[model samples]
Target: MGEAAENLNYDCNYNMFLAKIMLSNLSRPEDRQKAVKWMKKLATCNRSIEEMKLRNDFMYYLVVNIQQGELQPPFTDNPPTSPLPNIANLLPGGIAEVETNEMGEPSSTQQTKKPMLYENSPDGGAFLAAQPVPRCGAFCYLAVVAREPKHD
Candidate 1:
C-alpha cells in the first residue's frame, strides 16, 4: 500500500510538471494553434450570437460617440435627459415602436420585441457551443482557437 501511494504521488507530480511546461510553452505555434482551434470550434455561427455581437459593436460605437462629446442630450422644459438620438426606430423587423410627444420630442418609450433569433432557440448557448468557428477572413487565426479538431 505504501509503495502504491508513492507511485501515485510521483505520477501526480509528473503530470503537474508537464502541465507547467505546457503553459510555459503556450507561445509556441503548436500550442497556440491548439488553443485557437478549440476557440474557433466554440465560437462559430448562430443568429443570436451574431445579434449579440452586433449589439456589442453598436454599444461600442455609442460609447465612442459619447466619449467624443458628439452625443447630444435632449432638452426638457424642467430637466434634461440623454442627448443620444432616438435610433430604435431605425432598426429592422418592425420590432420596435417609438412614440413622440406633441412637441416633436421623443418620449423615450418603445415597445421592443425579443429578437426572433433569440426567440427561436431555446438552447442557444448549447447550439453555439456545438458550432465550429468559420474561417472567412485574414484574422481567422483568432478564430482558430475556437475550432474543432479536424483530422485528415
Candidate 2:
C-alpha cells in the first residue's frame, strides 16, 4: 500500500488508505505514529479544494480516534448542578417570569411558551377505548391512509 501510494505521486485517496491501515488496531504503535505524522502533513499540504476536504475529513477521524481518551465530554458522570433554569421554571406560571417586549410580544431573550398538550380524557389515559378488531389489521389502515391522495 505504501509503495502504491508513493507510485501514485502521493495521491490523496491512496495515501489516506495507507494512513487508515496504519491507524487500524492491528498496526504497530510506531506505524500508527507514522500515520498520524503523514496525516498531519497531508492535511497541511493540500493543493486543491477537493484534496483539502478529503484531508480535513481524515484529520478529523485521526484526531477523534487517536485523541479520544484526552477529549472529555462537556458533562461528567456526576456533573455539577446546571445553573440554567429548570424545565418547570420555564413553564407557564412557573417561578421564572418571561419578559415581554414593548409590542407586548414575548421578548426574544425569554421566548418560552406553554407547551401544547393533547389528551382525549381529563385523566390523560388511553386516547380511545379498544374497538372491535379490524378485518385487515392495523397495517391495512396505515396502507390505506398512505394511499390516500393529498388534499392540497
Candidate 3:
C-alpha cells in the first residue's frame, strides 16, 4: 500500500484509497503526512464535483480527528515554485469580493443572503426535526473556529 501510494504513475484514485487507509491508522505520523499530502493533491486536482466532495470529506475528518497541537501544515512555508492558477480568473465575471484577515486567510463571514427554509418554519418544522446536522460541514467549521485567536 505504501509503495502504491508513493508511485506517482499510479492512478490518483488508487493512491487516494491507499492514503485513506493510512489516514485511519493514527499511530503513524509519517503515513498520516503522506495521506494528507495526497488529500491536498486530490482536493486541488479539480477532476469532478464528486471527487472534490470526497476530498473535502477526508480533509474535514482529518482536521477533526487529529489533536489541534499535533496537526501540522501539510505543505511547506515556501510558496509553490510555479503559481497555482487563480480559480476566480476562470469564471466569467470573476469573484465579486473576498474578505480576508490581516494575515490574508479568508474571513469566515457568510457569503450568501439566503435564509434556511427551516428558519421560516412555525411550530412543526420537518427540516428542523432532522437528526444531528451532517458532520462534514460542521467539522470543518468547528476546526476553523477552534483555530481562531481568542481576542479576549
The global Cα lDDT (0 to 1) of model 3 is: 0.45
TM-score versus the correct structure, for each prediction: 0.18, 0.24, 0.27
Q: How far in Å is the alpha carbon of 148 misplaced in model 3? A: 45
Q: In candidate 1, where is summed lDDT lowest over 10 consecutive residues?
A: 72-81
Worst 10 residues of 3 by lDDT: 72-81
**Residues 1-152 of candidate 1: C-alpha lDDT, one tens digit per residue:** 35544444443344334333444344444443443332232223123433334333333333333334332221101111222223343333222444667776656575545556546666644655566764222422122335778999
Q: Considering lDDT, which of the candidate structures 1 and 3 is the better prediction for this target?
A: 3
Q: Would you list the clashing residue pairs of candidate 2?
A: none
Q: How close is candidate 3 to the true structure, as a TM-score?
A: 0.27
Q: Best candidate, TM-score-wise?
A: 3
Candidate closest to the true structure, highest lDDT: 3
